[model samples]
Target: MDTNTLMRTLDGTLTCTTLYGHKYRSAITGQDRMPMALEGLTRGKSLWIDSLVHFTCPLTPQQETQHLSRTPVPGSVCLHTPEETVTLHERGADVSFSEHDVPEDSFLSYRPRLLMAVTNITITANEWQHTEEWQLDLEEI
Candidate 1:
């Protein structure tokens, strides 16, 4: 699992183990190719590899949502990646809603039935956030 799917422990330390795809899949696509093993601090040094039985690993996606540091409310939308772009779609009235009737991002554009009378909207960028990974290596720190 990547950092996006990883959860940190109480002391701001991350615990993870390499998965060979037996009990739980390693990567998101289920292809186990982790370059490093579990990390731990013992005595005073940082340890990389640990016994398989002693390693801390990420849980499956389903299991993760349950115990997430920010647990998702039932029926809420969950974006797995920061780069993931989501478009607005109005689910039917039959859509199961939890504490909210509509998703936060979709609320402004949401229509009760299906369609709306909105004509136009202007898009503006207020801030320039971090760039993608491929652009990083090309720039000098």
Candidate 2:
């Protein structure tokens, strides 16, 4: 277990834990005024709150391949992080996020993925316990 507390209930009873991931949900509201127009479509529109995820973890080469396969090539991927689970579409559509970058030891921003139907598979290869570890810098996708 990661032992990092991600979320808690209002009463401080429920808690969410994770090893190396964080979730952030942001909402942007837009309102346009048109006195001449009688249509209700242009008055104000509410948008779906988008999630910005920053995920970092270490895995073996085989595990890396599995994650790549899990990600949708042309579509969105539903992310199940330690904070929360949400169905998200990949914003950048880049498939090489986990290939080169490594995250430094810093503060992880936590805010808030996936449906209950599909379970996420996570494979972590810790450097202290495994012979090989592949560090990744997963962005919003």
Candidate 3:
């Protein structure tokens, strides 16, 4: 399948390009903070939550070029799609923090109001397989 056709098959394809930020908390690492006590040490060992967003779609050559030109930059704004949220929910995902109050059900309209940065963008083309796909990876800023 070509990239454009593959995109048409997806429920939602992200088109918006606006970057936003959200507050995230992580323990002060040993390099940054000295443990006050055994409890503090134990608590510090707890894993930190670094939200990640990944999605794949087919893009036109122009779109692919645009993405290649825009991504992996510190200033680039992120884009998202409702299908991404729905998929995450289906997979039992949770938002540890949210800019808006998340209801127990039906946040299909909710677009995460969190700041994210593009970490990587990958384009794969296989002529024999007749497949071209764009993979976007984002990490919490």
Best by TM-score: 3
Write down the TM-score for model 2.
0.20
Residue-by-residue lDDT tens digits, candidate 2, 43-85:
1332222234444334333222223322232333433334444
**TM per model?**
0.13, 0.20, 0.23
Ten-residue region with minimum lDDT total, candidate 3: 61-70
lDDT of 1 by residue, 12-59 (tens): 998665444322111111112332221341222321221122121232
| CA lDDT of each prediction against the hidden true structure | 0.26, 0.32, 0.31
Q: What stretches of model 3 exceed 4 Å from their correct place?
A: 1-109
Tell me the tens digit of each residue's lDDT in model 3 across 1-141.
322233322567654332343333222222112222333322113322332332233322222111221122222222233333422221112221233233333222122223344444445566666655554444444
Better-scoring candidate (TM-score), 1 or 3: 3
| Residue pairs clashing, model 1 | none
Steric clash pairs (candidate 2): 76-89, 84-113, 85-113, 85-114, 86-113, 86-114
